[model samples]
Target: MKEITSTMAGTVLNILVNVGQDVSIGQEVIILESMKMEIPVESQISGKVRGIKMKIGDFVNEGDVLIVLE
Candidate 1:
């Protein structure tokens, strides 16, 4: 299993992948809003999305686990 973590503190703006969805490396899986900027959070590895730990409008801190892949 692979864990995807947030790179910065921000509010989750969108979630692009659903559970069991296949994702490629570098694919944008989530959009985050911080400092008035839209930041795309991408997948680091290719795999199926196993779980989502955050939801849209949720506030997250840097290094918080956002998704799990397998």
Candidate 2:
């Protein structure tokens, strides 16, 4: 399994893919709000979405896993 982790502390703003959905490399998977800015988190691998570790409005620290791929 592969995971997409948060690069910085933030609140999960949006999730673009659902569990079991196929995702491509570079596709925007989640949007994070940090420092009053919106940051888009992209998929680093092409695979099926196996899990989502965070929910909208949830606060996350740097390096926190956001999505899992398989």
Candidate 3:
């Protein structure tokens, strides 16, 4: 399994994919609002989404796991 992590401390603005969703490497998976900017969290590897570790509006820190892909 591959872990998708937050790039910065922020509130999760949105989750673009769901469990079992197929994703490609570099595909945008989540949007985070931090420092008044929108940062996209992307998949690092092509795989199916196995779990979502966060929800919209949830606060997350840098390096926190956001999704699991397998």
What is the per-residue lDDT of model 3 for residues 6-68, given as tens digits with 9 covering 90 to 100? Answer: 888999999999998999998999999998999998788788999999899999999999999
Query: lDDT by residue for model 2 over 1-69, one digit each (tens)?
Result: 999888889999999999999999999999999989999988788999999998999999999999999
Deviation from native of the Cα of residue 26 in model 2, angstroms? 0.6
Clashing pairs in 2: none
Query: Per-residue lDDT for 23 in model 1?
Result: 94
The 0-to-1 C-alpha lDDT of every candidate, in the order given, reads 0.95, 0.92, 0.92
lDDT of 1 at 58: 99
| Error in Å for residue 10 of model 3 | 0.6
lDDT of 2: 0.92
Where in model 1 is the C-alpha error above 4 Å? none
lDDT of 1: 0.95
The CA root-mean-square deviation of candidate 3, after full C-alpha superposition on the true structure, stands at 0.8
Task: Give candidate 1's total backbone clashes.
Answer: 0
Could you report the Cα RMSD, in angstroms, for every candidate shown? 0.6, 0.7, 0.8
* Candidate 3 clashes between residue pairs 3 or more apart in a chain or in different chains: none
Q: 6, model 1: CA deviation in Å?
A: 0.3
